[model samples]
Target: MLLGDVAHLRTGDKGDISQISVIAYDPADFPLIAREVTVARVLRHLSGVAVRAATRHELPDLGALNFVLEGALNGGVTRSLALDAHGKALGAQLLDLPLDGDAES
Candidate 1:
């Protein structure tokens, strides 16, 4: 699932953090796919901002994982989201970043 869906997003202090409950596919599915989807959604919604790290956790009995997306925002500021005449964020300027290997999806 995308970070924009069913996730609580927080920005400030250290970085941008997103917490999501684990889905039905998480436990049996490949962790990479889930991580990739989560990361991509987070980065994309925030406009391709790189994350310092994302940690996943499985709750005791609830069977959910909380994902934390760190350092993906401009230190929680509005300046990075402002567009000059055009609709865009500063992170949008980095759209040309090349993707390598198997993470192209």
Candidate 2:
């Protein structure tokens, strides 16, 4: 199964940094997301992009996982020549990450 099967994605950016927020549509799936969506896994999934580091922040109350990525904007909107310099597509890309466990039906 895929991460997107159980959760939704939202993205944000600042300078050379970016954020990917993975929120579970159902509260029951939060624990599964927390286990499968680790910093290492996210970094690996985003290996095609130039990112310095990744960190996972848990928002238990909100049932979400926020991953803050550093040096991932290709030098941000002002510097990057890429069409989508804001990295809006990154969240969609991350949705392809494989889910490691049986994350609900």
Candidate 3:
């Protein structure tokens, strides 16, 4: 199953860093999201964009996972030549990440 099937995504950016928040629709599915959406997986998923590092911050109370990705903006919005230098579309891209088949609907 795809993460998008169970969750939604939000994104923000600062300098060369991109922040992505994945929030589960059902609170019960938070555990599966947290377990599957790790820093390693995120970095690997966005590797083509030159993401240098990633950090995952769990927000259990909100049933969300926030990822801080460094060097993701190709030197930030003003410096990057990429069409979406702010990385707004990155969140949508990440929604395609595959999750365990057991992921709840």
Q: Identify the candidate with maximal TM-score.
A: 3
Clash counts for the predictions, in order:
0, 0, 0
> What is candidate 3's lDDT per residue for 1-105, written digit by digit as tens?
888999998889989999999999999999999998888777777768888888889999999999998999999988999998675788988888888864322
lDDT of 3: 0.86
Indicate which candidate wins on lDDT.
3
Model 2 lDDT per residue over 1-105, tens place: 799998998899989999999999998999999998888888878787888888889999999999999988998878898778575788988887888654422
User: TM-score of every model?
Assistant: 0.38, 0.90, 0.91
lDDT of 1 by residue, 14-99 (tens): 32443434343334333433444444543454454556776655553443445555654544444346223111232233232232
CA lDDT of each candidate? 0.40, 0.86, 0.86
* lDDT for residue 42 in candidate 1, whole number 0-100: 39
Q: Pick the winner on TM-score between candidates 1 and 2.
A: 2
In candidate 2, residue 23 scores what lDDT? Answer: 98
User: Model 1, which residues run further than 4 Å from truth?
Assistant: 1-15, 25-47, 77-79, 82-104
Off by over 4 Å in 2: 101-105
